[model samples]
Target: MEHMDSSMDIQHLLMMGMDLYRWTFHDNWSEVVEQYKNNAAIHTMPINNKEDTALHVAANNNNAVAVKQLVDEIKRTTSAVESLKKKNGKGDTALHCAASIGSLQMCMCIIEADPHQGHVLIEERNKDGETPLFLAAAKGHKKVFFYLKDCCVGESIGLCRRTSDGQTVLHCTLYRDHFELAFEIIHKYKEGIVGFVDEKGISPLHILADKPSAFESSSNFRWYNWLAYQCIYVKPLRITSHSKSQQTALRGSTADTENPASNYISEHENVVPKNYWTSYDIFMAFTRFIIWPVWEAFGLEVIKTSRKKKEKHVWCGQILDGLWKHKDVAYVGGRVKAYVMPKPGRETDGPKGDAKQSADGGSQKVTADQDKLQGDAKQSAGVGNQKVTAD
Candidate 1:
């Protein structure tokens, strides 16, 4: 090989200096810290095509030593720490990128370099509206989650901040099956769950119920099941007075006209109303609590039998009788009557007497007057009783 020229030697030295800077970032070498202090040229070099300064690359890679060196170099050259205001293509400061990756050490370095960078923590959102904490929670990075949590505590920044879809990090944790993290977040921020609806009007319970596959797939399904069960059973701590008033109105309108007007007018007599909580709401809430545990403990055979189309009426009839027996407990002292409409194969049997049944049944005196009024509409017109009583 021909002898190397001084010009080529100088170019080689420059390339070596640039490579040293890149290697310092890649390996987090401490020696480069000393060299960076002496040579200002190495301080300003970019690594690769990302236009990342030595500081940006080291922070992105979580190289704490290399980051310290670059920070020191900038402070030495510019006589001010503000020269560290480098940003990449996405407009992320080095702190933003490091926090996105859950780099705790680099985060501390940047924060210590300038506590003002904490503002950037909340400001930096990826294309998905994910803050640093959001990404950390999504990844189940508990340390990072708490780090961001402490950063936001008492800082006028709500940790329960919503995503574009209106999902708080807690919602995401639940959806992603990060159950432990979800519980921690909920415990820390109890109100986080209340009134949190997704893009759909679905509440958390609705979301959980609609995704049976997720329920089945979770490795810790028992824990999730128990949590869901508890959530369902824990009644709303504060019931609105409006709901109470609506219940009272329904009770007043539906009370039996035969009862003494004084009895109907009594405040205690009409305390609990019917139809306040619809059957569907009670059924869904009760089923959510009971179905999984009951199914798992005892196989679905009993439930399946009760659920069969042919047996539905029989089961419902039994359930109605059961409710009638415990009406005081079941209905909370409300008026309780059981009326089982005749099934296709069944006949009325002249309204057999049952005290808990409707008054018509308990009366048992099927007078002609009552019969005429009960007559089918088709025959009643011929009877010329234009009273046109309903069957």
Candidate 2:
């Protein structure tokens, strides 16, 4: 049996594949129906050129009817499902071929006909180690990509197989300028896809940073739009009527007893507006959060004035880079070593697992910060008590 299967030649498969492909031009698949009746070989033979079956050819040609017929024929035999999975020379099944062509109907026909069970082929990878979802994304086929994503019922969209270089479909979508598709991937797999970094320690955030144009193409920063008060997008709103509200949320706003807007704004629409960043942002994001506190944390006051720093209109990325660069400077006698980001989502891990060991060393700094927080909390609690004590 093995010898017989191996003996099937290129000429035989081509003849079979060609016959099936010819039927796709018909309005009702009449030629295919006739061919299926008169010649079963055309339906059963594997095209040896790319190792594709007739279904592969039909899918590439975008003939949903032909794809379904081929799928149905395969379903007639239990072992034929194995044939459906057979890859061409490029390691693509019929579903992969359909995805490459952005044919949603053809893909539906192929997966729906799966004799093996629910959506096994949806996760199948091609020669590049990409699932059908990745192919659709790379080809800029948003509709087809979502269809496959929806088929992922009870499981992930099978983004498990990255390219040989270790990039996921998210990487491919962003690289291809498939912003709509990329957003869909992020929406469907936020935690799993967004934090995914390739071998180079690059996350989707890194990709988005490189391609800010992607924002115009399909902006999803709305989730953070409300968070703009963090000092990136809220600058514009501040020059207007929202400052008191901003001040109230971050600091305490009780001083403005006459200004109800401040209290109302803080009570409702939380977090505020700004340009990407400003002097206030620089302090809030970096200096106030780290620098001023660092001296107290490590009992090293000289560290602040030890060096004259260049004053510049630092943007968000620059501020982040600076902080990550100097994050460990608080360590006792720590010379500035070259900076390395923890694996995406592992920023707290420090330089590899070695940072994991010193997890105990920061207890003092944490306690100090915590104690300060406790003091502030008590103050806030006391204020609350005073306000209610009158009642």
Which regions in candidate 2 have their CA more than 4 angstroms from the true location?
A: 1-44, 77-80, 157-160, 212-391
- In candidate 1, what are the lDDT values of residues 1-391, reduced to their tens digit? 3456877866865785677766755574666666667766555455556656667777777656567666766666653234454555555556656666666555555544545555445445544555666666776655456555665535312334344564556556656665445545544443323223434333333333333333212112234333333233212111111121222233223343122222212122234465544564688678758875687577644344323321222222222233234223222111322222221123222113111233233323212132222222113112111222222
Model 2, TM vs. native: 0.48
All models: lDDT?
A: 0.44, 0.49
Top TM-score model:
2
> Which regions in candidate 1 have their CA more than 4 angstroms from the true location?
1-46, 71-85, 116-120, 153-166, 197-207, 213-391
lDDT of 2 by residue, 1-391 (tens): 8777766655565665666555553444666655655554555455446656556767877766666666666666444556677777788888889988986556656766653453678767776777887787888876566666666645443353365655767667667655445544554444444444454544444454454322222222233332321233212112122232232242222232223333222221335344324455566678657766874598644333221110111122222232223234211111222222222222232233332322123222121232342233223222111321110
Tell me how far the alpha carbon of residue 239 in candidate 2 is from the true structure, in angstroms, after superposition: 31
Error of 1 at 290 (Å): 38
**What is the TM-score of each predicted model, taking all chains together?**
0.42, 0.48
- The number of clashing residue pairs in each candidate reads 0, 8
